[model samples]
Target chain A: MKLLSTCSLRKVRGRNLLIVPDPCSGNPDRILEVTDSFAWLVGHFKEDVFTVKTLAIALSERYGLDDDTAAKEAANVIQIWQDYHLIEP
Target chain B: MAGLSPDRALTLLFPLLRLSLWGTPLPDAVKQETRLLNESDWEVLISVAKNQSVTGLLFQAVDSLPEDIEIPDKTLVQLAVMADRIEASYRRISTASEIVLTELRNEGLNPVVMKGLSCASWYPRPELRQSGDIDIYLPKLPTKSGRHFQTSPDGSLHFQQDGVDIDIHSRYFDIHHHTEYLPSVPSPEAEWMMISLHILKHATTSGVGLRQICDAALLWKILPDNSKASLPIIFKATHTMRWHLLLFSFLEDYFHIQNPLRHISSKPLLSIIAHGGNFGHHSTSRSRLLKAPSFIRKADTAFRFLLRIPFSLRFAPREILPTIKELTTGNLQHAFTADSHSILH
Candidate 1:
């Protein structure tokens, strides 16, 4: 799934951060801070929804992780994004 | 301009605020504005914008650049990204306010939202304003609710659930608390007085930023024409007439706000506001003041810190007294406990 239009990846102090605006943050706040890996995924999947396999491949290529581990991490990251409505399937 | 040292950082941040708050439409000046900012400068500017609670608005100001404004390509990319983050933040604030206000009302708390959310309506696009924690009247509600409230070291009561934060205030000033604070009173005088005092209190002690000063300006701007005549009387009663006048002048002088609420700007007060951009955080660092190569400069820094004690004592004795007591006697708990009566302003 693609990142929601309401959310954007920002570079703050040289760190990649995902800034999710209100309601989308699942609570009241103008913005919510998220991790760099999550930011990487959002950046990678900016337009189209990517399959779990595609995400795992990207993760494996980026971090040199084994296929199974990358797939698991990709699932976990995507699940978190879905939970926050940062992405939609 | 006593405290102002041609700070490169504030120069960028303050004008950006002017654009955001006043809708003044600066199409030309912005071209040369962000030209010299290095990474360190951007860091400080971003940090100050967040501290002043205006990051989202700053993004809006920069993002509205015309094709002719000529912002650096990298800066434009950064701003486009920041605009996305800020938009998300605006949504989060709106959602959070709705959830918290609904919860509070359902509990018969009679919650009255304060500051950020309340002042936002006066802006051109309400969501463009960056919101901090949702501030509401004291958490002690009407129906004997069980929501626990915590007091942080900075003397604000906060209610946190999941990842959302709401700061509960018992009084408009440092010394007062009322369970029936705002829910019972719908007076415009009370609202204006509170805004005035907030700006005054922050300016005298910690040094306010453009965001705070703009709140005061917007409050004045939104007041009905009939109500405008009463500002002097209200200010006089709160004993903040002079301070309010000085702030209004600064709003007019630097930020380009027109039709000010008052006309009182002396050199001394202007110097204070100019020097203390964003809580007395000028362009230079404080340690540099102490490390001055000249004896006079070193003494000035020491004297300046000492001089600030009385104002600090007057406005925020709750924080300052405890800090001084701790510094001298090495005691901790006594200076910082949460109590309304402990600090008498």
Candidate 2:
């Protein structure tokens, strides 16, 4: 079985950090407390296609937020994180 | 299939129950009964059948009849009594094995028995050590020599009496590359060294816990100083402590067994550190190491290293990593199936 990259995007002290280096760089970025939901989304999906439905479920569980609000907020935050290059498509 | 006789079934069931309680899964009834058994009762049965051949009446007392399919109350009581006897036997065998190992050394045969026997002789208490088979290490040619060795036609070691199983190994790590690190040393010296390395590697890398390393250190302390000369052979056989250390580091970073390094008594940990190759400081806690993210990296590195070993000397890396993962993750059904396909051929 192939070993998959586990690096993910995180927020350390309010600054968005990429915990893992891009594969091309061979050095990982250091971020703090980037919840598994964020990591899973970033690791498995392209940022451009990261949907509100997926973000909602992930955020609801990740931050203990109620469903509809979490969905709305996660979609917005994911777009912002993407715009900031905290995650790559 | 040959169905077990009632008496034989009881004999099998008692230990199976204990093993299940130890960690293996078992039927609800058996689990319930096992929970009712006190630690002392558990100790008793383990002690009796550990290393002796008991026949006739004592056997009958512990044995149940095939006609009675279920485990009878009388049989259970007998089992409790037998547990004490078995535990005593475990101790006696451990002591005797220590003596026998010394004799084997005198005969110029390097011998190291693994698992429970090692635990009984090396661990704090016989009961704490549980093993179903005897794993012995036999030193052959080094991996660098480009030679492969197998057990003799008669087998490396095999003898059976009553119903107990006895197995002997001339090698460890069914894959050839891993076995290559084993080098022939002068008898008991080799045994002691192998056991120490096994404990160290398992504790540090596999995250199996600190108890094993503690046991190894205890054994090292108790063994006569005359065996000290053999310590170098372990390094030579395994090609320095780097491989084991790296292996442990990788495992710790990935699998997250435990950091006995932190929990273990200072004295033994100090002893290991003083020896100085591969044993070093690790900053991460056990929990971080167990998560999938860390494990993937660690496993990847370990897998890469195994791949770099000379192919001729190596077993299929493709097979080893998955098997190790399955085994470590407690997927025994899959692990056994994978093991049969990879090793049996």
Which numbered prediction scores highest in DockQ against the true structure?
1
Specify the CAPRI tier of model 1.
incorrect
What's the lDDT for residue A30 in model 2?
Answer: 32
B4-108: candidate 2 lDDT, tens digit per residue: 332333343433522322223345675455445444453343333332222112233233222223443433443433333345445555555565456556657
Q: Candidate 2 on A1-89: residue-level lDDT in tens? A: 11123343433223233344446743443333455455555655543455667767777876789987897787676665655455544
CA-based DockQ, model 2: 0.01
* Candidate 1, position B52, lDDT: 56
- What's the CA error at residue B129 for candidate 1, in Å? 2.1
Fnat of every candidate, listed in order:
0.07, 0.00
Off by over 4 Å in 1: A1-89, B1-6, B27-51, B138-143, B151-157, B173-184, B259-262, B266-345
**Cα lDDT for residue B42, model 2?**
36
